[model samples]
Target chain A: MSTATTHTSAVVHPEYDRLALNRFGLWLFFFSESLIFLILLLTRFYLFGTSRPEELNQTLGLAITVILLLSSFTAYRAETAIAHDDRPQFLRNLLATILLGTLFLLGVVLVEWPEAPRLGIVPQEGFGIAFFSMTGMHAFHVLSGVLLLLMVYLNGRRGAYSSDSYWGVEASIKYWHFVDVVWVFFYPALYLL
Target chain B: MEAKKAAKLRLGWIVIGILAVLTAVEFWVAIAINSALLYLAVLALAKAALIVQYFMHVNQLWHKEGHE
Candidate 1:
């Protein structure tokens, strides 16, 4: 019937609604951002060996890596809460996830990075350049995720998201997870290998 | 519905446990193996896959949702 055809068309035509517009735009932006990070990762391996033994033995770097890894779980919890329409739980988990991400970044800058130069490793050093460059780029992503989380929190305070409409939170969570994915690679390259 | 949500939460925690164990294994290999770096890289990749697929729900999203 014409009704059935119309229903199918509605599902396919995402631009017909605000929620669909937000979702479509976010995914498109995310895909492009992913390509940029992929290129950076390729450049990293091109400049440094895929595996480096000495760097793998570092303790401080490994610890910070664990922190970053754990934060991903918290971010997931926040997203899950939002998906299920638990506003208070979503807000709590979102704040916790952001705090954890900020700590991960702080650990990288204050602890792991300071120790790098002390180990006689300068950015000008061959592997050192690739190391700092790749990890530094990932840190920048984390900072952006933190800022995005703050925006989500502000919007949430204004009652912007609900079970039926939470594209903003969903998009922010997607980007945060991408930052986590980048660190998953950077951790091993810079600390484990 | 609440019970289903709780179950999903439990599943999420289980995934977190797997990630933690993999991270520990990475640290161990880096310390124990002579070719530690190579092993560490492999383990790290495994852990990354787990986090992305489960924590990020990339697999679920890709299969069910068209985008976003």
Candidate 2:
């Protein structure tokens, strides 16, 4: 009598599936958040049409936009570094991103907010209502994003993530990028248009 | 693996360069052109696509779990 053997190799990595699911859930959250921003965007045009205030600080607006964009770049690098197991690069980039984010908030809150009223953009007027609401909502997101990055940075210092697993880092960076995307639309809507 | 990481790093710089140029052009258009809504909207969409695709890796959402 002869016997035959059939062998199958199945190496199950549950974390991979778990990570994918986690990412999908995060994206859904972003989609819902997007609806809020979209409604605010539509309100801007609905109330004020294409006309923007000449008093709007175009220079400061552009400066903060640049700062926010730079932060996104650093955040991207930080995520990529963690994915590649470059812990030092990841931490450094994370810090850079955090600094840029803080700068952006300062620009909006200290410079832009005070300058807006001086430039004649009050909370009561049509343009003022849209401008404050739009920028205010966005600034809140940036503040939360900065806090999340701080958490990730502290976790990184303790070696919480590696090439095989870094969901926390990924999730935080994705949120940061979403904030930048909002500003991408908001900058032009509030300043340029 | 190293090569792939290097490629990703390079891609990030290139995307940033394009974004900077687009932002400059956006400023110029806003100043030089009176009716710039259409142009600005297109530029904004393009910028968002770059961030979503390259920076955020939205394609990874569709890729198999291990692949991303």
Candidate 3:
């Protein structure tokens, strides 16, 4: 009995190790991706010097900020619901997050860009290039996040998560919120300053 | 247990409300007030912190043991 207990205590369930390992790996990936955004910010400041285009629609920027933040809240709700074993609420909130995220991408790519041309806006040296590059990169992240959220939502609808094993929901929501956090910085940087 | 979760969910709404108000303030400061770039940067960092903490579950970075 003593030897058996020792053996049992020496090892943990693989699920625990797997979850911890996954979290570590995901965060490592985030850290590396942060470098790319950092370069974008550096490039923006290097090029613009504290000045941005006044014609760059602050109103629409604010609107995009609001929608993306709303999606973060929805993502939070989805994770929380799954933590409590509420599958239906989890599914609904995840879908809401995906929808808001998609709208944010559209607001940037379709609405913001095409509208820029009509505003008599021109790249004007490196200004427009840097601005588009920064926002475009962020838009890419948003698009990827929306796709991931859809996968999570679909898996969740099939009852893949539970109160005890909801790491899938947690990881996806973390990614969603990370994307929102990036926009919190990017919105002000691109549109405000 | 259920009640605790319900309470947490309520807190989620409150966090988003704070985020909304902060973004509005960012809009005002950006154009109307014309605050310094440093101030805007600070506001952006605050917003990021709120999302990462409450929404991203950064606090749970080491909580996977209990989760699993």
Q: Tens-digit lDDT track for model 2 on A92-186?
A: 99999999999999999998998888888988886899999999999999999999999999999999999888989989999999999999999
Q: What stretches of model 1 exceed 4 Å from their correct place?
A: A1-4, A7-31, A50-57, B60-62, B65-68
Q: What is the interface RMSD of candidate 2, in Å?
A: 1.6
Quality class of the docking in candidate 2, CAPRI style = medium
Model 2, C-alpha of A158: deviation from truth (Å): 0.7
Interface quality of candidate 3 as DockQ: 0.73
Could you list the CA RMSD of all candidates, in the order they appear? 3.4, 3.6, 2.2
Better of 2 and 3 by DockQ: 3
TM-score of 3: 0.92
Please give, for residues A21-81, the per-residue lDDT of candidate 3 as tens digits.
8888888888898899989888888877888877888779888888988888888988888
Task: Give the higher-lDDT candidate: 2 or 3.
Answer: 2
Highest TM-score model number = 2
User: After best superposition, candidate 1 residue A124: deviation in angstroms?
Assistant: 2.2
Q: DockQ numbers for every candidate?
A: 0.47, 0.65, 0.73
Better of 1 and 2 by lDDT: 2
**Which ranking of candidates, highest DockQ first?**
3, 2, 1
In candidate 1, position A113 carries an lDDT of: 74
